[model samples]
Target: MQCPQIVEPEKSTQARRHALWSTCSPPHQRNSPMATTCPARARVPLTLQRSHVCQCVFIRSPARVGAVVSRAEASTAERRKTAVNMRTPRRRRHRSLTATAAATAAIAALSTSAVAPALASDQPPVNIVEMTPELTKKMQHEVDTFFAKHDLPGLSVAVVTPARAGSDPVITTFVAGTPTLGSSELVDATTQFELGSETKVFTADLLAYLVATDRVSLDDPVQLFAPAGVEVPEWTDPQTGATTAITLGDLATHQAGLLDAPPNLGAGCGADPGCENPRPGYTQTMLWDAFAQPCLNGQPCPMYQPGTDWLYSDWGFGLLGTILANVLDPVIETEPPAYQSALDQAFLDALGMSSTELEFHGDGRLATPYKADGTNAFHWDNTNAISGAGGLISDATDMGTWVAAHLGYVPSTAPIGVQAMADTLQPISDITMSCSIPDQCGPAHFQMGLGWELHHAATHDVGAAWAFKNGLTDGSSTDTALAPSLRVGVTTMYNKRLSDTDQGLPLAITLLKLLVADQPAPEPAPSAAPQAALAESGQPTAELIVPGMMAAGFVAIGLLLIIRRRGHGRRSTR
Candidate 1:
């Protein structure tokens, strides 16, 4: 290395060359000397090259180093300036980040909140029940069996539970028979049948509605509302000689001493040669006049004192209906209209029972009334003055709506309580029947309510307690029953005019029992304090209850899972 002396280039020349090389050199090799030794042919044009390379090199070296130093200083100053800028508003920067995070979280929270209900909507609704395949099949089978056994031409039945807030009721329908005996038109749930005495229930309800609205008072004397100069027959107390007036309650409760049917209903009769009009021809006015007559001369008397006993009297109910019409006329602003017709539209229409009505039009949809012998030939007579007692025509679907309303399962148009309806369904009288003639009577105990019949000790052995009513006319037999204990209700409308001994009522009972066969026993009544203490002390109470058992089971399962997870965590740690 000491063999030759290496003279350093002059500062100006070195600087000049450095400048020239700095322009040509790649950024990575700018400091290397070998970058300058390229051939002239490989070099850039001399004009474009550095003029006076030695001088250029000498001038540019310090300038290049200074420029580098200046750049480094500027970069350091920029970094310091950035650091200062960052430190000056440290709290503000932190606050900004925190605010941004909070804003982002709030936005995310809002989005999540909005998305939850949408997701819930997307999911299937809860608390809804679909008819199980087994239930459907059983219902169908039962309906078919009934048709086959009864030799029905066509029949349709609709069973509905009370509707829930956001869910429709479980409506199970079966259509098995034809609408007409000859036409083979399939019957559907919309098929209409005369409701018969079932109309009495609606009429009674309307009367109750009027009473509820203060349109009429139950204790108001019927004579007050009776047509002008129409004297309502009165009953006199034998001891007091005081005239007893019949009240609206007497008529409604069937204690008005009215006859079961019109008096001398079949009076005008003669031999075929000298024929007279038969079938008691009593008009509404005539019935009212007869009611005005004294039981004996100059004394007001009734069969029994008002509200003394309950008798099944169509006349009593008829008078009640007439009074209801009079009371409702002024309030509804429809004077002298058919009271039954107005009641149907006001209450039933609002409830969405579009298929119900007070009259049957002979459209193809109306089911023909028949006799018990399955004879389609039957008279379709007007209900006359007693229309309110037995004139409504409805189908199973519409009846279900009415039942739901009675059960407080549907909102009522009139402000009446379920207790009021229940009161109407209570037993007001004891009806004893003789079994001498099977068609005429049977061994039955009937308790009469306002419009309901309480059947005690029914044939069925399921301990059936029912609020029932039956309607029998020339060609139609209709029955409706509600079993509150079992939470079941039924409506059976037969086109045929069936006797009390016919299969309609029995069939309805049997079907109702079957429908409720699987219902759980109702909850046991709460024990008395002593009984409760005994139960707590492990002594037998009246009932052994499983209170909160399901909830306890779920809690136990959750605890077990938690314990197992803890055990697993301990084992894994080990």
Candidate 2:
């Protein structure tokens, strides 16, 4: 029952390192490289419904305990400490060590190698989700339930599993509903949906690719890439009266101390309050104005010292897009397209994300966004400057490929190096969330990776972590979650922008847990009160509410009749 001790190859050859790092599920007795190291465990049935999942890692130790970690575990711990410390301005480099080689090696050695064999363990067997009649019906049933229960206009989902022996990585995709309510056409793999802030991950991916290629550095000042006459904001510590310039790392991790949105986002709004929308996008001139003086009181004021705290800011990411555009424009041969073209060249195109784009020029494939009431909703338009903040439009297939790449499933066609994708998942800053009940939070830790939200469950091996991101626009929403150790990635796309209280997030998170650990999903604890709120208020449908209202009305009528009868009896007695 004991997992055998794995002996690291002395040479650490490229192939050996790859084999050591490519674990997807629990150990199997055949085919998988990990089968030789980790033995089998009993299978656990999934108990949680599709709507109760939260962001947590489920790691089941092999049948035996006391397994020794590989050599890389110590170095990874040191690097994580260093990466966390680097968030301070005193140590501003902010680059973590590359993917933990030994920790991954140990995980690979401990995990079941083949996807099918994972069925024998407490892990659901990772299978390729195709558009077969059976799978389509199953997915459609789930999608219909969500639509009826949660008010979703439409949905498309994709999940990626690591490759099994003699097989390619398994990608599962399913779509239900139409681009618009009246349209007869149902959404498919190619139908594009606005990604919203999910675009930030792509921006971060571009940054990582550039850094991996040595075209940029994490510590590079935002000022370095700005076009002439454009100024980058400076942060002044109010108490210390010391100042520092924001760097790309600070921007990527939301520690740049910038406002959530640029002040000029409402520029030229005149009297129309609704004109404040960023969907029209920020122009270069407006972007420059904000950068020159972020606070607009003739001051380049930042809320706090750069690199000192975490504050999610669309303005910061917008500025990042501008910087990346500046860095990429010189290298572009023809008239520079939207900054997205650079992203296409960097990874999207290479990774088979042909349907993903920042700009939609009458693409027939673009899904019609809808409101909760099934009415048409506005699709966000992005200018080059703010495109990276929340502008990319993508489909389930492309999103799946992007998530798969993070788990070391980069296809040979992808010229972009795997290290580039890995770099984006590196935890750069520790994120402390306020939990009313700290113990309920368990040993789960949170961090800001390049653009991903990193969640580490109780595991000594830092490599065993999950990274995820959520996106929302006026009309649509997207959620993507990945567990690299299990090589599992799950994403959901909705035509309607579901509320935070909706089941969209819980569904994705729950699906991930089901795949990663087949054990019954625990209910959301007090720490996940928001998730608990989902059961009560998350997009209740008319079918659920109308009957209750009818019952209440019937009861009220009966009470009124009783009162009238009592009054009649009193009059008779008189």
Candidate 3:
């Protein structure tokens, strides 16, 4: 068979630009040196791989330009699978590859097949699970209805279907409405959105990681990791006449009787002698100062005895980050802020979250935030002491990986990956109760996990386990939810600052329930990339399932076989 040839475009100017952009960065911009060789398999705790994981199948095929499928053989698939499943890259090779962004995107599009391997150290695996047509229509309707009525500018939601063999975590993403601010680009998988307080979950996860390794104890008093020279103004039990030290669990569960923030909130860093924010990007310093000056108006601030209260305090989390950073600094041997670097190691680097980062300023891209009134809102950043409170910047794609790990599906090579996830999901306190048993419990009854808030009664009624953390920021709102047993999680985010009556939280729950419905999943997966005949004409078309290319190839081969048989019959007649 002969194929048509395409002509090449003039490359005079393009060649010059490509050469310029491909050049390596200077010494100052280069990433820290990492080992030239990687280990065969990073040592992961045995506990990380208990059960229910959908191991990603890595198929290394020839990625044709302008194509979505790759053609590779058994040996190539094994090698690529080893890179992702066995050995997790120790550190990322941050390079001066700015010019290669487009080139990289082109290659990535080819690897969007279900078995695309995340071989490049910097590239997190991309998994696309084409959902049922009816499911797509249903989710789109829900997304559109919320955006239309709520006056939200833009929103992105990603759902993970029940995992099946021969695939990575089955992910389906929906981008709805045009963003009111920033580049006005359509909200998609790669777009970075502020994680808001959902960051606390990561912070709590870090603590759990440490606790799992015996490096720290959740029951230890807060003073254990406090910076030297900063005195934790003790709160004594009047009846016992002994100081009631604040334990780490108190902060993780929000049971610590601490203020939401010190002195001023949402104000710029002030140079005055007494200001909540004294310096930019100095969360640890500010956290230490808050405790050192744990008094207001020359008197100790109001703080109920530790473990007796359940007030949500961002500053309390800031203090926790400072403590965790101090403990993790020596262990990781990092020059950056200890806690921040530790987080990068556990999640961004080791756990394979390529699209996530701690800070946003001077970063590549950001989804602009807006107010409910359709006006621009300030882009809230967690540069100050409150980063542990809400400093994470991530996309729905990265969040899907995170969701998988928490659901005990995709375990990481990190020492405490699976254990930390379980610990974070454990219930710790009560938030509000359900209305199911009005006679036994009041309507305002709910449960709070280490980082996630538990939703029982209603969720249990549907035979699903649900938990979530609603993130609130001045410029953005984020809702992160989980359905553990059903193995589905969702992240709904909008640049718009949701007001009092916002439906973003409920919207996430509704979509999540639909994703993890009680009905059994179709064998393999019913969804595949739309074929020409099926997408175009109304005909009985073959479904190109999981690895979209294989099914397409089968259909093509069948038609060709019929053609050859007809040709032979004609020759026989002659």
lDDT of 3 by residue, 1-574 (tens): 1111121212231121100000111111123231011111111111111111111221111121112111222344577888665432221111113223434444344335432322435432223232455665677688888878787766777666543342234555566655545454566555577787888998888887777666788789887776667667667877898877788888887766667676444334545555433324454555556665544454453366676545677777866776776676642211224656667544444444545666574644567777777677666656555677777777765676567667755423223433366678887766543322112434445677777777773753534668888786667778877877565677787777767766434678878766666345444533443555454645323332234555445555565566556546755886
Candidate 3, pairs of clashing residues: 283-385, 325-339, 432-445, 432-446, 433-444, 433-445, 433-446
lDDT of 2 by residue, 232-259 (tens): 7687667897779989998998878777
Candidate 2 runs further than 4 Å off: 1-144, 268-281, 294-300, 330-337, 411-414, 417-419, 433-445, 458-464, 500-504, 519-574
Ranking by lDDT: 2, 3, 1
TM-score of each: 0.58, 0.62, 0.62
**Between which residue pairs do clashes occur in model 2?**
26-112, 27-112
Q: Per-residue lDDT for 540 in model 2?
A: 36
lDDT of 1 by residue, 1-574 (tens): 0111112222331122211121122112335331232112111111111110100010112232232222323565688899765653455446545655555455445534322322334433332222334544565576677767766665555554322222223344455566567875666556777776677777777766665545677788988876667777787778998877888777766667656654533322323444332322334555466565544333333666776655556666755765676555532211223654446423543333545665656656677766667776443332445556666677655665566455444322222422234446656556554222112445445666667767654545535677777676666666666765444566666566654564643455655655555343555443335555656767453223233333444555565566556546755885
User: Cα RMSD to native, each candidate?
Assistant: 37.1, 26.3, 19.5
- Model 1, position 547, has a per-residue lDDT of 30
Comparing candidate 1 with candidate 2, which one achieves the higher lDDT? 2
Cand. 1 Cα-lDDT: 0.51
lDDT: the better of candidates 2 and 3: 2
**Candidate 2 worst ten-residue window by lDDT:** 40-49
